[model samples]
Target: MGSLTVPACVSTVLLDIEGTTTPITFVKEILFPYIQDNVKEYLQDHWQEEECQEDVQHLRLQAEKDKELEGFVPIPVNEAEIQQIIQGVVDNVHWQMLLDRKTTALKQLQGHMWRAAYASGQVKGEVYADVAPALRKWKEAGIKLYIFSSGSIEAQKLLFGYSIEGALLELFHGHFDTTVGPKVQSESYRKIADHIGCSTESILFLTDITKEAKAAKEAGMNVAVVVRPGNAALTDEEKASYPLVNSFEQITLHPVQ
Candidate 1:
């Protein structure tokens, strides 16, 4: 951060979801695994229901689309065909497609149910140890907190609302999802600035990925890339272009007078 230099104008904070607040591996290895483990049961239990069937089928359709694009013919899923979908999930190949609208929405709801599992000691959110303290200090400093993540808004809510350490959702004042735009694109940050009602200069973006930080910086926000373990392994180019911090604790804030 010392090298990249915090802009004097930054006032509010815009953060990423997976690596910034929660661990990436946590989502990939734990949360995703939980959803996969219970997916068949959840789908089976809710197949006939209106709300549930639509979502499950919606995901299947998306999976089919991906397969079709990959040149594999897809089979439609019904009660009898669902087992194959579960097989895809269990194999962990199809699970990455959770980014799709239908699957993403379903994943959001599943996060809520996973809350019970986490609350009952079945799972834990893998936030880095540096997370809680930095969040507390920043909140106390009156840096307005906001979220921008590809994860659906509801999933973001569930994560902080029923986090590993208990509910930390109250720390944030607003949330933005992919509905704004993709994280890698420039427009998403522009829309987020409008939504937050803060000048782009007043917003500081914190993420573990350099590409996102670069995008935010291009959008005129102060950018800090976290270099946490289990975070993305940056390329040499990423290293030169952004200020890097090993942890949130390394972030030093200077108030604009």
Candidate 2:
């Protein structure tokens, strides 16, 4: 693994979940498949609830735009159209999971479904072996930790709260999701830095995605591109452009100024 000295001013760590702290297999093999298998039933069971209806409406709006983009005729949204809309939304959610799209509405709905799964012992979140120890070390060192993932904030909490490492949610100071901005956008990192009351240069952003790492770097944050089993392989050019680490144990932070 490659290494670089963390800047002395760094005081906060922003972590990406899927491939940074957790193995990608847990998402691909467990979470996504669980949602695909359970979502339609979850929707049918909860469709009348206020929050579920709101999310269904949001999915309806997205489905409408999708139909328009595909040149399909627009269906009028009405009480008579409600079941059709719900079914369409369910089909769309399945398709999005197939493609691994990270739209906010989809994530919000997934979080709700995963909430039930976690509560029922049907699924448990999996983090890399190195994550818990690293989190503890960083916390002991007084570096505030935050999660910035495409998952909804609720989903983030559920994952850590029910993680295999056991109720690790309390280890984090805050969480951010697509609600802030897309992970690949530099503006999102800037927003996170401001939200955390830290200078961009004083935060270290860790992710397995090269584009996200580059965006954090462009936002003036210290960035590390992580490499792990089951993560997307980085190109040689990408490897050359960012500091790379294979494990969180390799990360070392200096005291804040």
Candidate 3:
């Protein structure tokens, strides 16, 4: 592919993590399992603390909302019952119930637990071969690169910094997590533009998901849909509507008008 035309103003590149820089299965399977296996006990052991109490409240509120949304209601319960309920929610991958207000606590705790696994050689972060070299080349060309992922910024940093190829965080200028907003929402991309102090048109958004690319495009950003091998599930219309590439090597920045 040739360089894309924007206004003569593009200056930054914003990339997503899972399925873009990292494999999506690692997140959905390995990382989520690691988090789920630990959260119940982490919460149970830390329940008396103020932060833990807050997270419990969030879990309870989330559970209630989730039950209601699913056309059911949670019964009022004792502490033990609530613990069992929360554990069940996590185990079943009821993300709507487990990942909301205060989900950061669980994600952070999971990150800490995962550190040992990564350090002791039990796990390694998976990255596509194209990502690291492309990032370095972009950095060398004086383009500012930022990470926008659903993963916590700390988690993002850790994944890149401890990558199988080793500390690649040096290439990224900044990171954003769900605290900014959900990846599929236009506000998230807007917030990233504001945070970067650049016009949305000056930033190029790259991801494997169409909805996310749509969100960024709605925020006035140019979007690239990365079609990594056997990783994406784009619908038929998606194949015709955007710049689709098999690797970052296909991306070439054009000077904005």
Q: lDDT of all the models against the reference?
A: 0.71, 0.85, 0.74
Q: Write the per-residue lDDT of candidate 2 for residues 1-257, one digit (tens) a residue.
A: 75467988888999999888888788778988898888778878897899898887777676666764443333346566666765666677877666667766777788788999998889998989999998988888899999999878888999999999898999999999988999999999999999998799999999999889989999999999989887888888997899999988888787543
Instruction: Score candidate 1 by lDDT.
Output: 0.71
User: What does candidate 3's lDDT look like per residue over 1-257, in tens digits?
Assistant: 34444344667999998888888888777766666566566556665678655655555565565664543334344456766755653553335425443444345455665665677666678799988888887787777899998777877887887788888988999999888989999999999999989889889899999999999999999898888766768887997788887788777764322
Give me the runs in candidate 1 sitting further than 4 Å from their true place: 1-8, 47-49, 60-121, 254-257
Query: In model 1, how large is the Cα lDDT of residue 85?
Result: 56
Candidate 3 minimal-lDDT segment of 10 residues: 92-101
TM-score of each: 0.79, 0.85, 0.73
lDDT string, candidate 1, 5-42, tens digits: 45566668888878777778887787766876776666
Clash pairs, model 3 backbone:
7-256, 7-257, 8-256, 8-257
Ranking by TM-score: 2, 1, 3
- Kindly give the stretch of ten consecutive residues in candidate 1 with the minimal lDDT sum: 92-101
Question: Which is the better candidate, 1 or 2, if ranked by lDDT?
Answer: 2
Each prediction's RMSD to truth: 4.0, 3.0, 4.8
